[model samples]
Target: MMTVNEVSRLTGVSIRALHYYDQIGLLPATGHTDSGYRLYDDTALEHLQQILLFRELEFSLKDIQRILSNSAFDREKALKQQIELLKLKRQHIEDLIALAEKTQTTGGTIMDFTAFDTQKIKDYAAQAKQQWGATPEYKEFEQKTALKTEKEVSAMGGQLMEIIAAFGKMQSMDPAAPAVQAQVKKLQDFISEHYYTCSKTILGQLGQLYTAGGAFTQNINAAGGPGTAEFASKAIEVYCRTAK
Candidate 1:
């Protein structure tokens, strides 16, 4: 058996973290010395390694606990999942780096944008340009956004938050009301004028996306206040039902 300090030295995991893991029942030691020191066997080290891998992949402690404790937990399967997620994340970072290099000022260092969806955002930006660049709305939208400097984009994002805040104000009302529907229309128009032509189907998906969590959900909830995402989602569902 190895002491907590031994594991820390060997794996570079802090003793504090290991203790927390034990506190959370994540990586309890196999035994304890009579003098009250924690002792971990070789099998416990393997479990710790798996926990570290999940942490590197950004899995929450609660999720990691459930997964590792499950009877179906398979080390090989987990490693494969880790590999795929890492590759996808690396690709996103790489593409952002390449794009930043092209548009950046001379010698400007690439800023960390982990909270931003570099790939997904770029994909949405290109969607209309690829699908309907010939349409006047797309052309007009492209022209407008094309002139936006980085500061303008930031400002535009702030304006978008105001729209979301407006939606939050209507949360107590029935989602099928004319007022709610009008706000939904405004939201659709906002995307069509700024980004892409947001049809009812796409609008519905965007509502779900807002509630899906991450920085997007965080920003929406922060801007519009709590329950805003769910409110918008319910409103979008009602709007889509009416459209059909």
Candidate 2:
């Protein structure tokens, strides 16, 4: 048996965190000392090992607690999972190390993104353009946006939220109504300003994505409840057909 402090010193975990774990019933005390201090036995040591392993793998404490509470939780099975995950992490780290070494050999500093293969850069740009669109003035746009900080993103998000709210207000209006069309134009302008130039193909694809893509629909639904994406799709499609 060992005191909580002894366990903390031996395990390198903070004493407060161990107390928290005990308070949450994750690593319950095996018995109390005469002085009312907590004591842990070998069983608790095994559980602590599992907890530490899960924490190292980035599992939330709650998730670790739930995993360990299950009667079917098997130590060997969990260890096997940990081994597989650690192997993958090791491979990822090795790849990063190779990339770093290559960069050093090529006289490329950390921020020298041009050191990356042009093909990889082109592929990423193509994917982004497909998802959004192109602005011929994008170089200028990038220059303007390069200095934007976290605070600016939060402020920009607020403006977008307002635009989206106005969009929601127009949902019950007739799709063919002049007001709805006007709102759709505003939506197009919104995307153009924040993203890039709007293309017909991208617009059509965005409409389809609202209904067909899980990620798109999930984001829309999560924002202001469900059906927002479907409504936006209809409004955009109607706008596309009628716009000059």
Return the lDDT, model 1, position 203: 83
Per-residue lDDT tens digits for candidate 1, residues 1-244, read: 9999999999999999888766444665666789978888777787888878777766656446545633344567777766766676678778777767754756665566663465643453333124323455445555777777644544554555578668888888998989988988888888777766778877887788777754345446545667887898889888888865
The sequence of per-residue lDDT tens digits that candidate 2 reaches over residues 14-127 is 888877665544565666799988787776787789889878766656446535633334667778777766665666566667778987898866664433434443353344
User: Could you tell me the C-alpha RMSD of candidate 2 in Å?
Assistant: 16.9
**Candidate 1 overall lDDT versus native:** 0.68
Clashes of 1: 0
Q: Judged by TM-score, which candidate is best?
A: 2
- Each prediction's Cα lDDT score? 0.68, 0.61
Candidate 2, which segments miss by more than 4 Å at Cα? Answer: 109-244
* TM-scores for every predicted model: 0.44, 0.45
**TM-score for model 2?**
0.45
In terms of lDDT, which candidate is strongest?
1
